[model samples]
Target chain A: MTELSELHEAPAPSHAGLDVGNVDELHEAITAQDKTRIRELLDLDLEHPAELADRLEQLSHSDRKTLAELCPDVFSPALLAELEDDVVEDVLPLLSSRQISRAMEELESDDAVQLFEELSDEAREEVLEELPEQERREIEESLSFDEETAGRLMQREFVAAPEFWTVGQTIDHMREQGERGGDNLPEKFFDVYVIDAHFHPIGYVPLSTLMRSQRGTLLRDLMDTNLTVITPDMDQEDVAYLFEKYDLISAPVVDADGRLTGMITVDDMVEVIQEENTEDMLALAGVSEAGLVDTVADTVKARAPWLFVNLLTAMLASSVISLFQNEISQLVALAVLMPIVASMGGNTGTQALTVAI
Target chain B: MTELSELHEAPAPSHAGLDVGNVDELHEAITAQDKTRIRELLDLDLEHPAELADRLEQLSHSDRKTLAELCPDVFSPALLAELEDDVVEDVLPLLSSRQISRAMEELESDDAVQLFEELSDEAREEVLEELPEQERREIEESLSFDEETAGRLMQREFVAAPEFWTVGQTIDHMREQGERGGDNLPEKFFDVYVIDAHFHPIGYVPLSTLMRSQRGTLLRDLMDTNLTVITPDMDQEDVAYLFEKYDLISAPVVDADGRLTGMITVDDMVEVIQEENTEDMLALAGVSEAGLVDTVADTVKARAPWLFVNLLTAMLASSVISLFQNEISQLVALAVLMPIVASMGGNTGTQALTVAI
Candidate 1:
């Protein structure tokens, strides 16, 4: 196991988690303009991008700008993928169009699309111009879909095998493909879809099943046909529900004619589930913190609408109580009863509403 | 594509989801004692066990009791694993000790442990006596851990290989082991642990990576050492956070000696995330509906405590309002302001609490 002290040279390819303690130390290093210490603390090859992204998110605004300026390597492509969208929006202006496009090329398709989406319109045009034609088309085609739909979420890169291929043939193809490290093969995948002439997935086979089966077994015979097929336009939440309900490792995303166009994997579905849950929680609380990213003004704007609605209702409630002002003046006990009853009723309503959501 | 009508003979191996309409039809079929129809509605071959479990969950208690009596096979082992804990508690009593032991034998180790935990002490003794010695021991060992720790959540069955083995050798071993249909090979897995002599995972090879590697490539060279190792004693929520943060498909669970014991998969983490999120939501609402399974009484017992607490606090507020009774008597406007102030303040507090949570 790699110790925390040796993080900059750690063997882990990526660290998706970070400790807050690391951030405090990084802050001091940035403030002192210790470029050597910054590089030692954040090696491009060894450290997890998430560790850096988290550190940057917690930094003071000027510290972040200074760090990015002092150590441009700090905003590695992987770090761009892991950074929160708000932070990404803030950081993109610091990079050149070539730098941004190079980052897009280095990342997987879904991440590349996300990074592309963060650019300002003028920057998007410049970055898109700098990207390879193939890379540029993938980003543009993915962006054509409605946001939060399966089309937007699916990676154009996936593994698909014809039904005629045997396990041995499929393995040979994958080995050849993996060597090339092309856009067609996903960075990591669990299942191989068995497609028909029209590119529809007739069935799918988990890699584990393919591995343990006889090499001579046809992909068709080895395949499990009970796939929960997802259409491109399906809502991401619905996509997530299918993944959860089926214990799916990955599902094929298809076109109108039912041809497999792309695939959505479980790792992405994990995020959608959390997002939907947070949305549910926020909805129940009557707030909409969904897009409130950077400014304190944004936070206030997000939180204020619900309070304003609450105030309007509160005023309505006050009017109802005022109708009984005569009775309250005659008996002080009536006034005491009003607050108790109102408060208890409000709490009970909140409890019921929470469960309903 | 498998249309909605092809459900009974559907090629899909499992459905972890259910349609409410299907549950309603199952209810009608049960009332008529139409065993053929019931079986057609829930063919163990093509249907998802969750579909049946959901049906049982929604049935009236009397309908459920009668359905179990009329169709004993409705409680399939897969359905036993898929069932919500409350529904399992209700259905377990209807099964013979022999039947329960059989279900435990059929299910994966983690699910077998969950089913065992749902049994009454008397029933557990009977079921344990009926189980095979190894199965009985596995359940007992799993039960020794805290309810929501990694030990309780992980499946004891996993695939691990020595680092010295080549890809071909590892593949051959897996094929031979998978052919045996034993407890040690998980039904599905994505990664093969490359472990030391003592069974500590030093690295892991994603099955896809194995598929793409040349047959003669050594497992040691092909493996990724960026493992996010989990301990048996870790809280399941913490385990889930690591999965979401690190985008892990499966993580090896280790014991005190840092030797791999079991593995937790993403499917289980999905449930943990939802469970934690729900718990968080309910806690925010000042309620605990955690164990309120079957009865209306159970619901009241769960929700009343929070409301009672609200009543006590509201009474304190009422006393404070009474202290201002003389002021309110002079100005009716002061009384009107109280409800408006109390309501808006409560809403703001609720919003802040929601965010803090």
Candidate 2:
């Protein structure tokens, strides 16, 4: 494996850092159907999965498909996770079921669930069947949770310890687990929950605190019991609010009877906050979605329903203008000033609605 | 310190969980100048600072002031941090300089900077003078950075170690620091930066890694060098994008020569994400700010500029209608359908703009 130090030494290919001039070159390559040039350009960005995703997003649908087909290895599991849902959906059919299953296996449960959501039902079944039984079970269990709930957000792999254990025991156990190279442990965790008998989490110890504490310190004594316990049924928005309110690094999710089930990390909450924010902003502007890389047809489809509702509201406003027809005829200025009044009122209403939301 | 378990055991006073019927009762208490009843009502919400902030936001300006005056303790530093800028501004003059300084003292640097931004120049001077010298200096240094930049967003107190230190040595250093309970250390930290002799951050070790590593492991070998380094002048929105892309828990900010300055944590980024979200949402609606707790006059002030701009645009639309006056007189039906067409075009333009933004 390439060490992080080597990765840091390599030039980072971030979306924001990409030159506008390079984009023109990229466009030229795509237009020429120059597979060799496209591969070279993609090679420059292959190390930075996010940048690869961004570059993919910048391409037209046909260009994206051609590039992906030409250099399938560039579309790694991490790269797929970095791509937007729309882009991922666009590319999912290009890959084999084994490839899709492999990507899902490598990702955290929440991210895998997200990719699963974007797949066609047929594709989903194929991919699920290809996955290892344990991975499939975890994904299926996560899918059992309603969309936009804590259950959907929490990762199944978490580190936990009995309350009776000391900090030293927990540390040793984690070291042993790491050495064993098992798939049971979380890929990364910030806190370890201290669970009581019957597997109810009583508290958690931040890794920083655990690191600084004495080996003899009991897990329960060192743990912070004031942490928020997330119920699986809690709405993602409420879960986000709880995280913001408490400045939580990670929170334990509990079953209905309060047994520890999974954990939701702040990283996931950050994504939720942005997603919810985008949804609210787009909804207010009478658009279903922002559709940054959307085709003309997609854009129209996303916006048509909101436009129809707006058409009704506009007609109602016009009808009220008609009610003053007699008044408008006496003073033609009324017709001229009429739109100003209506427009001002509309702007004011939007201002109030924006604030309220 | 109350354990989070005990806090959880206490009935959670949340805005969603608040009795809708009690809003009227709250209004009556304010109107009757019933301080005792108001105190009792607020006490019901005391455990949940965010809920208290929400309840306070729902009240009229005078009522919020009255409630604060009646029960000053309810407006704790945590509660103050949760309130909107406008609401905080309204209550600032109600408190003594001592109170303001104490609140500032209690909050994290990023939060303190927010409160500091809202204060009047005269009040700011008074509050600054009242703060302890070290805190005052820290606030001054932070204030020196431009608003909405990493410098303004970063907290000064962070953990760092010399690059040559071993894991055990670093852990021992943090333990001694935590034992000392000095103001120099960060109240909470996620990772320890490994610094060179020049105080430049070379790499960082997540506490999780530090906890699991052997005592003899060199800090240099344990640290992850593939880290994003933020500059002081970087915009907060860009900072947020980095956090989202990298799923960063914390990032180090460096000075011109790449010396470590401070760190920006994910907790502060959560708030920044929301604030930026609100700003973008309101800006789309043509409002200067989303003054959720604004008085009628404040609301008008916030909306007036947008309304004036709309007035200009509406008049332009009206002038276009006036250009067809002769045709309108001949066919009054033109007058009836004119607004429908105009409104539809307006809505379409907004939809395009929303998507582009």
Candidate 3:
């Protein structure tokens, strides 16, 4: 939380963090095993966790391990959260149980769930053991929900107010809560849900609207009743569609009984949109992963399954061509044109399939 | 703008707007050419422009044209903004110059630019001439920028404050401006840029922080200087990457001299992400467009160029195989095995290319 506050206070990182000079210098340092230079370069980027994550991703596997060993603190929770899933998987085993637990604790519930889900059973259990009782329970609860559902995507922290509250009262409450500086409020929120006595979210007021409205305006009057409510079991793609269709910044997640449970923000939706897009693109190409940062072995493994399927399809296509072999020998021209015909047909079929998808 | 306010006040449109029943009824009405029934169905969906857009897309080309002729207002600026580029292109010729110009004027600058860009030269001229002088200049200025750059993507209207202004001054300025209800301010804004004497953006204060902060706090003191400023020439894809990396809601778009020109909001970014993903997916498949709502003819036109390229490649591969024509005739088995080998190679090559991309 302190780091989160500091993140807002610090100037934005220079995009030059990924420039050729820095990468080459870091590569040279890692090559020479110059711990001092590596530490110096990393320390300069300490406040910019995203830049640090990008730098680590560009490093050799052993160099990444060495850097982690040299400065475990650089692999902060924010940095871990920012890393690609494959990169996180690679680095997670290198960290101690204490580091894993601390990172998990620092992340929001949804992010903590993602990190824990990626871990091996034994490591996950060890990290879970290190967490406090309350946080452990929350993570466990989140894990119970099916993957890629609203339940799994939503963060537990959210801001809610009774419908009867006035705009002034809500503002004062937020100010007082900000001063209190506890975990009761979301780290950042775009809107506040207005709930009824039964805790069913009746509507929502965008923070902008709340800010602009007269102080005496009741939350009920100010709230947009046309708010979209999401169910915990709803698929994440459907949730993303809702966000896009409505231009929603944040949405309230409801339980089976229609009571507000947690909230899903647009930042989470942004990630989901990217993930789903990657999934669709990869799946269409018959690969299992995006393979953006995959090692050679990983890429081979991902492609092997699709290639195996392709082999069977190829054999089937060949079998059909075999049936026409006798006719092909009678006419040499047939041999030349046969591939043209087959090629045309295959290309046309692929074209149809692509458009259909 | 009135529609925008109504959009906010009205309860979130029923996801049922595109339900099977309504679509069926609308389809039946269109097929039967029941103008009254079509109007009834569209009237029921008047408040839900997105749903209306979806329904219109699902219709046959003639039916969509008929529906447009029956009730042109149903094809509102928001609906035009929501339609697919291809669909919009198909429908644009059917609308009057007045309808086209009015729609452009009603939409935000980014959306207006998008709609205008899809028009044919003669129609674009007609629409531009029909528009008010000031709005025409704005759209023309937007068009002057290269497509897919920050300048093309940013809205002309945004909120910015002098660095020396206190939070109270900023709040009062916004309130007074809101009351004035002119086109000078963005319809919605999440943050206020704090600019220096030179009108260069120095930092920003999120609306939430502005609301929570004391009124007397100076803008310079309250602003979070850690801001990611986007240059007007920056590619939209690069802008999207920055937004994703930083989880940014909005970023300032600056000119060559570094003065803030306009702003790109998350809602626009969300649309850009979806468009980029669609582009990538289609490009990988070798198709020119997603062909989501395309007719058979349109689909063929879209796929023909890629299929032609495939034809050339296929012919080249066939020519390579023809080099061994003597060997193949001597051993009949070579004919059967040739296809298997070619198929396997093609599949493997495709797999590699997919991963590389």
Candidate 4:
């Protein structure tokens, strides 16, 4: 097993153990279009998709595309899921519609929808046509909901049991379904929603609760009835807030008639929390989103608009100071005091804004 | 069933559904020290610890003290766990050592250590003496770890099965443990570490996987050997990064000898992520931590030193401008031009700092 090399480990092999992450070596491989070296470099990271995506993100635009074309098989669905949306948009156009469609089909619906969202309009149309009707409809329904809503963020696959089921019956049902699994059940789920005959969730049983309970215990008796039900159209931020407030591992999402439609897990909420926090920080600094792989032009585009606003505001302030030029010519002391007064006000104003934000 | 009302509801009850969270009502009840009214107010919030903690945090300091006195029984271990560190520090002195020791015994060791850390040094000695020996040792062991390390953040209560055990035997072991439960297991856990004879964590299985697998499958066959083991000395921030990178629900914490000592779960990691992000945002503004319950004096205490430094820098700049005052007296245009150049450079410097941060 690889050591988690990025973490602050005790002096072990001088921190040079993660030589596989040396992007300079990969950059040369990409520059020379050396497929063998590229494959060797990638093999080290194939098991760690996020690390592979990070390497791809650090490469130049042309080099990344060259690497992708040299080993198109390296761009697995898991690798695609790990990539930044901005990077995915760059890479998606290079692959065929059949390849993109296959990846979407293989991924969880929530991730599939996100990847599909980044495709060009024409590519989306082509991919949708190629997809199975059921898969295509699932993607369309998720897209129908607004971006950053629970409907879009939730995975269509989940575990639910009826209220009348016993612990033994529930296990049997899940085991039989597991044997037949092909997107029928989520890869991981913490809570099994206890639902009524109408498929409306009444409560949830954590898997731990299920594991510890006797086989004959009824599902209703084991579940905590004070379930925090989430509506599909709820904002992702609010859904995240619910998860944090309740310390929930997963919550069932309901549709208009209060029937269970999907499930939203904590792993997705982690990403949303980070995204929201980054936006909050950037907003305070008067800048918009800027990703690592963003070009110099893109960085300039994001920062320049905010700087221009500050410049206009500064010019307006300076113009007012110019109005005092006559008074300053007679007594230069007035000019020094004036800047001091204005500067004090500006600093205090920003400090207040920072704390309030 | 209380609706998750703070979430955008689809016009259920005109958004007045969470009137139980009304601070004005609680404030009046608190100020009166009306025990009956306090109990009634507390009853509404009993099911939701975080909401109850939120109300306490919003009350005036004096009113809060009065309320705590009126209904000390309301300060449950779960409620204390939900509270901010600042709030807990203020409330610790009011409780008896026995009451505190009982709470610590009931809570998971991670939360117990956190609450124990906030006690007055004298109170810590008193509480430790009152606690049962094993409980005392657990808290003391956690306290020995540096603040915000994996050792401090992880709870000692985790499930581990021997490598030779089958799924059926493991479930039977958990069921037997459950029948004898007081704190033998965590209230919730997502993974089970499969350990070797030497008690080193070799791999793990998610509870979901265990639920779906056949009864007779060996844990060694079911476990994922590519486990991300966290050393107790690892920074909590780095541990949280691992969680996010791998989408881990929980991971085993090991000692220098690689023996599994404790488990850190995703819920704790979520809190750490938020705390780290908040610190990042505050550092950008040159301020320290300020919580909701902090007084005006405390707020000023956190913010003043940075402003003082800014003040010294401004005075230095003004002194330089004074040296040019003689030339400015002859040419008034210099006065206006000086402010413009200085102001422009200052804004650009701050903008660059914001982006860099």
What is the docking quality class of candidate 4?
acceptable
- Poorest 10 consecutive residues of model 3 chain A by lDDT? A1-10
lDDT of each: 0.82, 0.80, 0.79, 0.83
* Residue lDDT tens for model 3, A147-265: 99989999988889999999889978877776676457777678989988888787889876775667788999888777677877788988888888878899988776777789999
Clash pairs, candidate 4, are: none
Best model per DockQ:
1
- Give, for candidate 2 chain A, the lowest lDDT window spanning 10 residues: A1-10
Model 3 residue runs over 4 Å out of place are A1-20, A27-36, A43-47, A290-293, A316-328, B1-20, B27-40, B43-46, B61-70, B93-96, B312-326
True contacts kept of 4: 0.46
CA shift of A152, model 4, Å: 1.5
Question: Model 1 segments beyond 4 Å from truth?
Answer: A1-21, A290-295, B1-21, B290-293
RMSD of 3: 5.1
DockQ of each: 0.50, 0.40, 0.34, 0.48
TM-score of each: 0.93, 0.87, 0.89, 0.94
lDDT of 4 by residue, B46-90 (tens): 357776887777766778678667787788899899988988998
Backbone clash pairs in model 3 (N, Cα, C under 3 Å; residues 3+ apart or in different chains), count: 3
Rank the candidate models, highest DockQ first.
Answer: 1, 4, 2, 3
Badly placed stretches (over 4 Å) of model 2 are A1-46, A60-71, A308-334, B1-14, B17-48, B51-76, B94-96, B312-324
Q: What DockQ does candidate 1 score?
A: 0.50
